[model samples]
Target: MKAVLFANTDWYLYNFRRSLAMSLLRAGYDVLLISPDGPYGPRLRELGLRWEPLPMERRSLNVLRESALLLHLVRMLRREQPDVVHGFTIKCAVYGSLAAKMAGIPARINAVAGMGYVFTSDQLKARLLRPVVRGLLKLALGGEQGRLILQNSDDVKLFRQAALVEPAHIRLIRGSGVDCGKFAGNSPRKNREGATRILLASRMLWDKGIGEYIAALRLLRNRGYTVQAMLAGTPDPGNPAAIPEQTLREWVDEGTVTWLGHVDDMNALLASVDIVVLPSYREGLPRTLVEAAACALPLITTDVPGCREVVADGVDGLLVPVRSVEPLAQAMRQLLDDPALARRLGEAARTKARNYFDERIVIERTLGVYAELCGPGQEARQRRYG
Candidate 1:
């Protein structure tokens, strides 16, 4: 049997679904990756999967381009003729599902990583586009051959409420996955008398709460709290909600937060930091927080769907209201001043990562979804689902 996975970017495919690809390959299925070519594309090829580039814009609104993309996807699906096709991210899921249906593929899975900017935004364009996307998803995700995979129950409920997908067709897989063993906890660094270091690692987007994070940091500084905060991500020029380079530079210049730009080594970086923060407006599941949890780092995040799913109140991390700078600052304040509490939360986070958010769990569950759709077909019987 053959499996084709569609992702928006090669980096996302590599960073998120490598384990799943290996798992499928080990199960004797030919695994192929469909994504835009980038630096990470060759790396995926090196890892023993076939890479096929598809020209898809990340934030384009042109009707002609999108229609052309859909046609190209249909042609590719017809050509590949794989037994299974799974799509990640919004555009891929919507387009892949439709293309697969058009190509007469028997099995389809669309992973709605998040509702994305359209559903999350309060702007008029987003509000106008919301119903259109809902209508498209409802049409694209319908039929016996198609299934919807979501990371959070909130998204599932939203889809159902919008009449997008039936309850039976949706699978609640927590995250893309994170390697528990790879992100091991630190060996307790020496105590310092200076400021506690906190990090916010995500693509520089306004919806990821970069603005709120800076505000919180500024609040801390104004209150005479000596906490070192860093924004360890680069601006995403492709995203509509991206934080501009000028704004990021101004924050650094104004002493609001240190900008580390793009981070390559998250494990090592998480180890050095005392706390991790993700004030994202929404997510399927924040991979950064999961990695931080695996690294046994305490978290300060928004009390939204994906964030709440990974963290319990006062257990492994602190959850604050979304877009609220005071509470965000207060949560960071709690961790920075209380070393013992931070250590306790970090340890609990590690345990949570091991017990629940491990990559193995995600891979097995996803493969099971594939198996369920395939029935007693060519899939190996030894899969964890079987």
Candidate 2:
């Protein structure tokens, strides 16, 4: 079987879904990865995976360019004629499905990671585009050959409520999946003398609650709590909500946060930090929190959709109100003050990661989807799902 994995950026494919690609190869599928050109394309090729670049502008609204891109996809699909086309994220999912349909592909898998900028942003532009995007989604996600993969139940609910796709066609897959073996072996903090290090690992975006995190850090400082605020990952230039590099530099200079730009080795970084925090407004089951959980690090994240999916309140980790500074600060303070509580939470988190968020489980589930949809002469099964 041949599978084509498509995404908006090469970096996303390299970092987030590399394990899934490798699993496909192991299963004797000819895997081809497609994304816009970037440094990571060569890295993927180095992994013995076939990677091709397709032109896509993340922030483009030009209809002519978008139409041309769709045409290009249609031509490529007709040429490659893969058994299954699996697309990650919103734009890729829609375009890949549309093109796959046009090219008469056997199966399509559209992974909607989150309710992205078009649905989440309160900006006028986003608001204006929402209905149009919804219409496109309805068109793209229809029919028996295509299946929609949602990361969290909340997204599943939202999609159902909006009547975007058939309930039977939607599948809940927790995340891209974390590598437990690789991210494991973080010991709980004990007898630490210096400032408590709180790390937030994500792209620097306003919607990610970077402002609230900074505000919470300031609140901690004002309360005379000595702590080190660290940020991993750089601003995403493609995202409209991305915080600028200059602003990040300014925060670093003023001692508000120590910004570690675009960290490749997250395991080492997670091991160094005492606590992991992601006050994101929303997510598609954040890889950072799951990776931290795999490393047995206590977490603090928002109570919103995807964030809540990983951390049960006061169970695996703490959950604070979204976009709130005081509650976030309070949660951080609590974790920092009580070592025993933190240790208990971290231990539980690791257990949860092994049970639910392991990459092996995800790969099995995903491959099952492909087999169900693309298996030779499964007419009865297709009818049941359809």
Candidate 3:
């Protein structure tokens, strides 16, 4: 069977969905990836799978452009005529699912990695646009062949209560499973001679708790904590909630946090850090926390859906309320002040990640979903592919 996966950008497919794609390939399915071109376009071609570039504007709200893109996608779906069409990210989930349905695709899977800013906001834009967004989702996933995959229960509950999706069609899968082996365990924690390094890896956005993190850092600095904060990720100018470059630079100049900019080596950076932090307002399942756990680095994250699922309160890491610097700082201090506690938490995190967040488990569960949707022929295809 041929499976065509559609998402916003090629980089997202490379970083997050590569495992799932490879899993599909190994299971004997013809895998085709559709997304806008990125640096990873060559890499995806090298993987021996078909990569189709479909121009998509990641941040544009232009209705005409979006409609044109949707028509283009519909044309592609009709031409490809895959057995199943899998959609990722918010835009793809809505538009791609609709196009696939229109093209008479047999099966469609809409993976809601996170609810994202649309569900989390009450701003003018959200208030004006939410009903349309929710309605589109309903139209896309209303049928029998549609399956809605959620990464966190909170999002599932919200969507169900809001009547955006039927409860019966929803399936919960834990965050894109972490590669425990790739993010190996860390050694025993040793006291930092003078400076303690804290790392935050996320797209620089206001809603991602960037402001709160900076406030917490300032508070810590005033309190004379031997700490230095480093941020790794590009500032997304397209996102409405993105942090301004000038503001980020001001913080850097003020010694609030060191902007490492975009770094390719997250594993190495996590290894070097004393503690990992993600103060994001919300998430589907934060890859940063999973990577941190795999690296045996204790985390300081918000008590939101995806973040809470991974960190068991005081077990593997600490959880603070969303957008609250006081609680964030307190959690950070707890880990920094007592090295023993941090080490204990980190060790526990590694164990939990290995047991629950293994990539193999995710692949198996996803394949099972495909089997349930497509029925017996999937096994035959798997055998043939093997």
Most accurate candidate by TM-score: 2
lDDT of each prediction vs. the true structure?
Answer: 0.86, 0.90, 0.84
Question: What is the per-residue lDDT of model 2 for residues 1-386, given as tens digits with 9 covering 90 to 100?
Answer: 89999999999999988999999999999999999999999999999999999988988899999998999999998989888899998999889999998887748899999989998899999999999999999998888778899999999999999988989989999998888999766766677779888999888899999999999999999999988889988878888899999998989999999998888888788888889999998999999999999988899999999999999999999999988999999999999788889999999999999999999998889888888787867566545643
Off by over 4 Å in 2: 378-386
TM-score of 1: 0.95
**Model 3, stretches more than 4 Å misplaced?**
377-386
Worst 10 residues of 3 by lDDT: 377-386
Ranking of candidates on lDDT, top first: 2, 1, 3
Q: What is the lDDT of candidate 3?
A: 0.84
Backbone-clash count (model 2): 0
lDDT of 2 at 315: 97
Model 2 TM-score, 2 decimals: 0.97
- Misplaced by over 4 Å in model 1 are 185-190, 377-386
Q: TM-scores, in order shown?
A: 0.95, 0.97, 0.95
Which structure is stronger by TM-score: 2 or 3?
2
| TM-score: model 3 vs. ground truth | 0.95
| Residue 98 local lDDT, model 3 | 84
